[model samples]
Target chain A: MPKPSPKRKMVRFRDRAKCRFCRENVTHIDYKDTQTLQKLVTTRGKMLSRKRSGNCAGHQREAARALKRARFLSLMPYIS
Target chain B: MPKLNLSRVYEAMFLVDSGDAASWDDLVKHIANILTRNGAEIVGITRWDERKLAYTVAKRKRGTYVLAFFDLKNGLAVVEIERDCSLSEKVLRTLLLKADHFSVADMRLQLGEDIRQDVAQRLMTERGETAAVVHAVVSKPTHTGGEPVLPEPSGDYEPRHERGRRSERY
Candidate 1:
C-alpha cells in the first residue's frame, strides 16, 4: 500500500469548525424570522444546503424551510 | 377547488404582539394541526420571542415573530391560513410563501455558506457602481462628449485653510 501523505492526514484538521458565522451568534437561524432567513437564502431564492453552510442538520433544515417561507411571502426574493 | 400538487413546499412568517405570545402559540399550533390533518409535512417551527421591530407595525413597537415551514398539497390551505391569520387579533402581520422550485437536494448544498456577507457585499457593490455612474454623469454635463473643462484657478477662491476656518465660525 502507498504511504499515506501528511497533507491528506491534515485535511481532517482543516475541516474542523473555523467558520466565523457559526462561531458568532450574528445569524440567528429561525424559521419565523424573515430578516435572518433572508441571510441564508440565495438570490435565486434557493436555500443553501448544509455542506455549503456548515450548519448542523437541525439548523440547516430550519434555515432551509425559513428561506422557502420568506420567498413564498415575497419578504425574500424568490428569483434573482 | 383545484387539486394542489402534493410535493410543493410552503413557508409562513407571522408577527404577534409581545404580550400575546401565549395566545399566538396556540394559533400557530392550530395551523400546524390543520396542515398535518390535511396531509402536509411539518418541516419546522421557530418562535422568536420579544424582539423590537425596525419600525412600528400595527401601532406596536415590539412583537414576537413565529416562522413555520412545511410541504403540502396545493389547494385551499393558502386561503385558509390567510383567513385564520386575519381573524386572530394577536397576529399583527402574516406572510405566506411557496417554495416550488427548491428541493431537498438543493437545500443540502447551501448549508454552510457565509450568506450574510455575500448578500451585503452584492448589495453594496451594486449600489456603489450605480453611485459611481450617477456621479460621473452629474459631474460631466450630458451634452459634452469631450473631457470636462477645469475651472480657472483664482486667488478669490478660498483655499482648504480658509474653508475649514469659515465653517468653524458657523
Candidate 2:
C-alpha cells in the first residue's frame, strides 16, 4: 500500500479573556454612548447578537437593550 | 395567601444636565435607592457620559446621558418612576422599556468576541473612508417564478442606482 501523505494539523484557537466592549481602560460603552453603541447597532436600530458581537454575555445583554432603548427614545437612529 | 411574582424587566435611559455632573450622579443614586427600597433588583447601571443631542430638547443643545436597567415586581413601579421623572426639572428626557424576553445568555451569543472584532474593524475602516453609503436591501418572498417584484419607493426621491435599466426601458 502507498504511504498516505501526513495529515495537516488543524490549528485550534480560543478568544482572549477580556471585555470586548472595553479593550482599553479608556474605551467606554454607554447607551447614550451612541458613538460606541453606533458601532454595535445595526442600521435597522437593533443591537447585534452576541454570537455576532463577540462581547461577553453580561455586557452584550446590557449593550443590546441599551441600544434598543436608545433607539426608541430617539437617541440613536433606527435606520441610518 | 397568594404568591407574588414579577414577569417584566425594564430598561430606562434618561438625560441630565451636563453642567451639573455632581447633581446627575446624586439623581441616579436617589433613583436607585428608591427602586431598591421598593423591592426592585438593579440589573445594571451604565453612565453613557455626555454628547450632543440629535435635536434640541427643552431648548437645550446638549445633554448628559445615563442608562439604568432593572427588574420591578410589577409595572406599578415603572409608572411611579415615569411620573417622578416627568416632574423632575433636572431630568431632560426619559424612556423606559419593558423587556419581555430578556436573556443574558442569548445576548452573549449574539455579541461574541469574533463579532466585536469585526465591529471594531468596520468602525476603523469607516472612519478612514468618506461618505460611505449603506444600502439596506430587504429580500422579498418568492412567488411562482416571473421576475422578482421590487418594492416601490414610498418617497419622492429615489437613488439613481435603484432606477434600474432606465435606458433599456426607454
Candidate 3:
C-alpha cells in the first residue's frame, strides 16, 4: 500500500471531489433506487465511508440509511 | 382506525411465491391487496424480479418480487402491514421503507425503468426446458463402464415414509 495521506487535500483531485447527490441537488436519497446505490457499494458488498464517497455529512447519513434499507429488503446483496 | 399519518410516501417490496399463480397479474394483485387492505394508497406497483432464493423460505425455493409505492395514512399501520405480510401464505418476505417526498412521476419512472421482468421471464422459460431435458436424459439408459445403467428414480424421488404410505394406498 502507498503511504498514508498527510493531508486529505493532497489526495488526488478527482478522489476528493464534491458529493454526488449534492452535485445533483437532491435532498432525499431514495433507497428504492437500487441502480444508484449499487454503484456506491464495493464488489465485496461493503459501504464506502463518507471520506471515500466525498459526501458531506448530511448526504453521507442519508446514503447510509438508504443503503441499509435496501440491504434489509433484499434489493441489494449484503455480500457479493 | 384513527388517521395519524401526515401522508408520507412509503415503498414496499414483497417476495411472493410464483408457484401459487404463474400469471403475473394475479401475483401482483395478491400482494397489492395486503397493502390496500390497510388503507395504503398505491401510487405504482410492478413486477420486480423472479429467481430462486439463497435459502428456502416456507418450503419454497423460488419466488418473485412485487415492488409497490404507496402513501401511509397512519404511520403505525406499517407495523401492522408487515405483520400481515409475514402471516400471509403467499408472501415470503416484505421490506417496508419510508420514501419521503418522492413524487408520483418518480414512482412511475421506477415502474417503467424496472427491466428485470423480461430477463427473468426468459430464465423461467429456460428452467422449464432444462428440467424436461434432465428428465429425458435420466429416463434413457446410459452406458457406464461398458454396462447400461437404468435410472433409479423411484427410490430417490420421495421420502421413504410418504412412499411407503403411498404404496399402501395402492
The numbered model that scores best in DockQ is 2
lDDT of 2 by residue, B1-170 (tens): 74577345565667877675456558767667756765666655545445556556788766666655566766677777887777777777888776433343222222232123342344335335322322211111224323323233221212223235641231
Score every model by TM-score: 0.39, 0.44, 0.61
Q: lDDT of all predictions, in order shown? A: 0.50, 0.53, 0.61
Ranking of predictions according to TM-score = 3, 2, 1
Per-residue lDDT of candidate 3, residues A1-80 (tens digit): 88767675354233545577788777777665555666665544566555555678998888888888767655566766
DockQ metric for all predictions:
0.02, 0.06, 0.03
Candidate 1 has what TM-score?
Answer: 0.39
Question: What fraction of the true interface contacts does model 2 reproduce?
Answer: 0.13
Off by over 4 Å in 1: A1-80, B1-5, B22-27, B34-39, B101-170
Worst 10 residues of 2 chain B by lDDT: B133-142
Residue B53 lDDT, candidate 1, scale 0-100: 55
Q: Candidate 3, residue B165: CA error in Å?
A: 58
User: Quick one: best lDDT, which candidate?
Assistant: 3
Candidate ranking under lDDT, highest first, comes to 3, 2, 1
Q: Model 3, DockQ value?
A: 0.03
Q: Which prediction has more favorable TM-score, 1 or 2? A: 2
Q: Which of 2 and 3 is ahead in lDDT?
A: 3
